[model samples]
Target: MPDNFNFEAAPFDTLSEYERNLLRSALSVGYYVPGETLIEPGSTTLALYIVLKGVVEERGKDDQLFAHYGPDDLFDVRGLFAGQTRHAYRAVEESIVYELNAKMFHELCERNAPFASYFQASLAAKRQLARRDGQNLAEFILTRIAREHLLPAVEVSADLSLGEAARTQLEVGADALLVRLEGGFEGLGIVTRTDLMAAHFQRRLSDDTPVGTLAHQPLAVVELGDFLFDAMILMTRQRIERVVVRQGSQPVGLLHLTQVLSLFSTHSHVLALRIARAETLDELQRAAETLDTLIATLEGNGIRLRFIMQLVSALNEQLLARVFEQSVPAAFRSRCCLVVMGSEGRGEQLLKTDQDNALIHADDISSEDALTWMAHFNEALKGFGYPQCPGGVMASNALWCKSVSEWRHELQTAAQEGRPEQLLRLSILMDAYPVAGNEHWFSSIQAQLSTWSDQGERWLSDMALAALQFDTPLTLFGGLKTSGERLDIKRGGLFPIVHGARILALRKGLMVRGTLARLQVLGKHGVLDQHMADNLAETFELFVQLRLSQQLAGDRSGLRQGLDVSRLSRAERDLLRFSLHVVKKFKQTLGRQFHLDTR
Candidate 1:
């Protein structure tokens, strides 16, 4: 292997040592200058080319650039397999590429199933393969209950005396004991340490009392194949310490919150605990400072990007809620609803960006009073690291902090006017998630908005069209167009996937918030085929991962929204190009579905 080459890159990464040796033995080098054509259209495939330095452009029959290959990037694999070239490869910059004979490449592919799959699989399949490759790094969180060792269940007959049940639990060193039902109930019930202590302290039962009288159904339960994270989420949501682990109809064991927490000591649970315990702004500020460190820790531990995004989002919501709780007066807080919009609303925010928030005050509350508290709330967030919204979309703005009736009127006006910008604002509001105060208020607004969207075809079409405003960074011939050294992954790839899904959800009357959840719901309802939904989900995740990697690497200097492609590894670049292609297909589908092309 060359000094610059790493195992994480493409076909080489999937190859066995023997196959890699075969590849290494057959390697040869070729160099080309800018505009020099390496393979002309309709030419026979002679070799597989892997760029060692500089850039290669693949141009289509129309002489339009479609794709670009940079250092450690591979090209011409499909052409080699087809035994002819469909497009021309030209040097975009002075470039050096390593060549391996097509015959040897064929032999290697024939010998290695994974190596062949890496080249021939769909983008979604490739992404799954990549995930599996790093499975060990993230397995503690993603692993299924069936894979982990479950604590043995300690069961006592419902008729057993409390003394006997307590002795059994103590003897078994179990934190909880199961009461097996005999006649009345069909399922077993669980009794925990707290339950036993509460019963004893309240003098509600005697030691001779039947255990059945004290037993109740478990707070939560998970099946054998369910991921640990699901169980953790349940425990977190319910404020419970453990959940019953079951296999089929039989009880397997218990999954304790402590077990999951022990595995992820640096998880969001710490932030959540801090938020819940914080009574003052100073303490919350101290807690907020740990967020960047938490993100860095989780990313370094190789947690899946989506899960990391969710964790960060959950933490952010807690931070915001705490700030709202501290900064807003109690009298006003109960009458108002605080919502987070944009990426934060969708639970896809991976970094602390601008504050996209609004307040929905009760009809009786004055807008002046709401704005005063909202200003304090917004300033508090700024002190905690969230910058003010550039477009003045924060709750502090008088226009945003409005009475319920006022917000309803604003939505009606925006939908009725049908201006492109107004529709765009309406789309942002569509993603709103209530983080603090009265959630019912926000839900009522959402219900109204859903009804309005159902009748607003022009509004939906305009929103969908906004997703296509930015041309995909990759040209028709597969070459990536860059703005200086930066490419805006957000606009080029993320927006189309997000807004397209949002539009689809609107038309279907689906109320889900996250992009992936919307796609899943759409797929479940047969609005989107499962394969296409999975492909889009994976593609969106890839774009998020790339942007996150860029942010985490401290590369946010010029063009804050752009990702510098030159800094990525060969495998990452390949995945990025494939992901971008997926985005292009997604946008084309959206345009056709929404009649954007005709408009």
Candidate 2:
């Protein structure tokens, strides 16, 4: 075996070390020049070929190029197992390959079930494995957390005096102490430096008072296996410095926010804290400027796309809510609801895009006042880095910013008319989430929309069919089909999964806002089989992650909505193509489920 061989390559990487060593010993290197044929149609299979360098092209029966394989790519596994070639494999460039003869290949397969499964698995199975493999990548934050040395929890008796608790905290050199509950309470409580300082300044209790009185119950807790990102969310949401770590309900240690911050330290927590503390638009803008830097840092650290989206969504909402509050008077704030539509509302947005927002004013508020406030709110958002929507789907537009009764009437009218464009608009509105003001107003409108959507099959079918607007970009031979230089991955892949999930959720009366959450709900309620739901969820995540990577790299250009496949590694391209195959299957399912052809 070569010293520089990359064992991390797919298919080969999936093999156990023993299997790899056995295969490696039997491998023989072969070379092919550009335009040289390695395998021809109807030719008997001789060996399993793994590309060590350069590219190979696979052509269909008509001699049309269908797929390209590069370094560390494997081919002819299916043919070698079946004893014949289905497609011609020709070198696209000068190439070096390692060959394992038929006898050795068969022996390896017979000895290793997992290695055999890697070559025999279906496209959906490959996608699942790819997703699982991504989770195991070295840069993932969870992988790092698993290797960390956690600190033990510093515990103190609830009956101890404040002075005694302080002395114990100093003695242990801990920032916070857990108070063991007795008598009335059954679980433990927590007391931090903030609590101690507040108590001492308020003069509300003497130092002789029991420390238990200072400790707060119902503490935030995380399991030992929880991802660091999840732990960060818990701390951010609860506004706490530390959380109790448990291993199956038994207290194990304390996870301090400062320790987490030191690990990554890209200033995300500081930015989030600043957003919470901002009192003016300028202050919010200062925090908003850090968003791009924060996003780049998180992506670089290999944080899961879903977690990154959630964090950015949370921060975006905070920025918008603060601007809304500062612009709209307190009196008017309660009378109206500020809602975000589309990706922002779904908590799946990764970067700042055009604003897709609306306002739902109370019935008592006059149209003039509502519009006046909303126009200011829109301009504020634009100034804060959110561009105005091209289609005018924003609060500044009087049509979108309306009273609850007005919205109710508008939806009813749209449903009755059943126009495709109106239905599309309504479909976008279906994803609305309240970011500020009276959420009850938005919920009231959502309930009415849900009732209408549940009763109308025609409407649901129309919405689901929109997902088929773009083809899945895969050829019949399961190879990618690209236009000139680019592929619109969002339209070709992401939209189908998202819209299909949305339609299913509506049919089942599932009110979940995000695509993955809706799929889980549908699966839980038996609307979709577990396997199908899991495949869709994993595929959707891959699409999001790929698109986000392109966006982060500033690769967005005219007519290019996804990554350029020619630039990706052999492994990445393989994963992407397999994911698209899953999308194709999902779209077919949606077509049958909705009777799209007849419609």
| Residue pairs of candidate 1 with colliding backbone atoms | 65-477, 66-477, 66-478, 66-479, 67-477, 67-478, 67-479, 68-479
Q: After superposition, how far is residue 338 of candidate 1 from its true place, in Å?
A: 2.6
Which 10 consecutive residues of model 2 have the lowest summed lDDT?
131-140
In angstroms, give how far residue 321 of model 2 lies from its true place. 2.2
- Tens-digit per-residue lDDT, 73-114, candidate 2: 778877897899899999989999888888888887788665
Per-prediction backbone clash count: 8, 0
lDDT of 1 by residue, 1-599 (tens): 34444556665677887777788777778889998999999999989888888999887877877677877778798898899999999998999988888989899889988778888887766765565433454787787776365666788888898878888888888889888875432478889888888877886778998888888774378888898877876665455778888777777788887888877667567677877789888889898888888877777666777778777776777778878888788776778899999999999886678889999989998777788889999998888877888899899998788888888888788767888777877888888999999897888899888777756766777778888998899855575667887788888988888988998898777889799999899888988778788888988888887777678788432237788888876666678777888788888888888888897
Off by over 4 Å in 1: 1-8, 30-44, 53-70, 88-96, 128-135, 152-165, 177-191, 198-218, 247-251, 328-336, 419-421, 475-477, 524-531, 555-559
lDDT of each: 0.80, 0.79
Q: Give the range of the ten consecutive residues with the poorest summed lDDT in model 1.
A: 128-137
